[model samples]
Target: MTTLHLEHASHAHIHGPACGHTQVPHGDHVDYAHDGHLHREHGGHWDECEPDGHAPHEGHDHRHGEGCGHESVLHGDHVDYLHDGHRHAPHDGHWDDH
Candidate 1:
């Protein structure tokens, strides 16, 4: 299991999987240039991007288990939710184009 060290303004050294990268949901329009570091906001949370020393993967899947249901964010693809053996696509409100 590879770990990623995220350097942020108020905090640093957040360890997680290499391929499991998540951007804090902050409305829309992500700004990468802040404090001379890669920054991402999601759900009102901010995190620093992986530096050049980190390895980049072609695909990234960040999923978490919540009770009997599961939530996931798939890169380069659509978001999906699996609950009780049934799969559901994200609602129209989840995307801006809709």
Candidate 2:
């Protein structure tokens, strides 16, 4: 993971189940995938959300790639495969929860 400066959204729009965006559970909060970036609601505003560290997916023997039978999302610098409501990215000979 990399250090990222979170930026607030310009518009005053609330994100939730009815927001029509993909909701991804990250840590203790839910992230909304919008306009090719992840957004999280904070203090009546929206902030850009990014992972803070490498969270390895233990016991993940399946490798994700072309024809892996999962939806691949283009995250920052890598591709994340959506599996069972979680996003998995390939890293360090294993998969990381991104």
Q: Top model by TM-score, which number?
A: 2
Q: After superposing candidate 2 on the true structure, give the runs of residues whose Cα lies further than 4 Å from its correct spot.
A: 1-5, 9-13, 66-69
Candidate 1 regions exceeding 4 Å error are: 1-31, 51-98
Model 2 lDDT per residue over 1-98, tens place: 54255866485777889998778777677878777767888777788887778889999999899998987766777777778777898988999887
Q: What lDDT score goes with residue 17 in model 2?
A: 98
Among the numbered candidates, top lDDT falls to: 2
- RMSD list, candidates in order: 13.8, 3.1
**Whole-model alpha-carbon lDDT for candidate 2:** 0.78
Q: Which residue pairs clash within candidate 2?
A: none
Candidate 1 shows a clash count of 4
Q: Which residue pairs clash within candidate 1? A: 24-41, 24-42, 25-42, 25-43
Ten residues in sequence with the least summed lDDT for candidate 2:
1-10
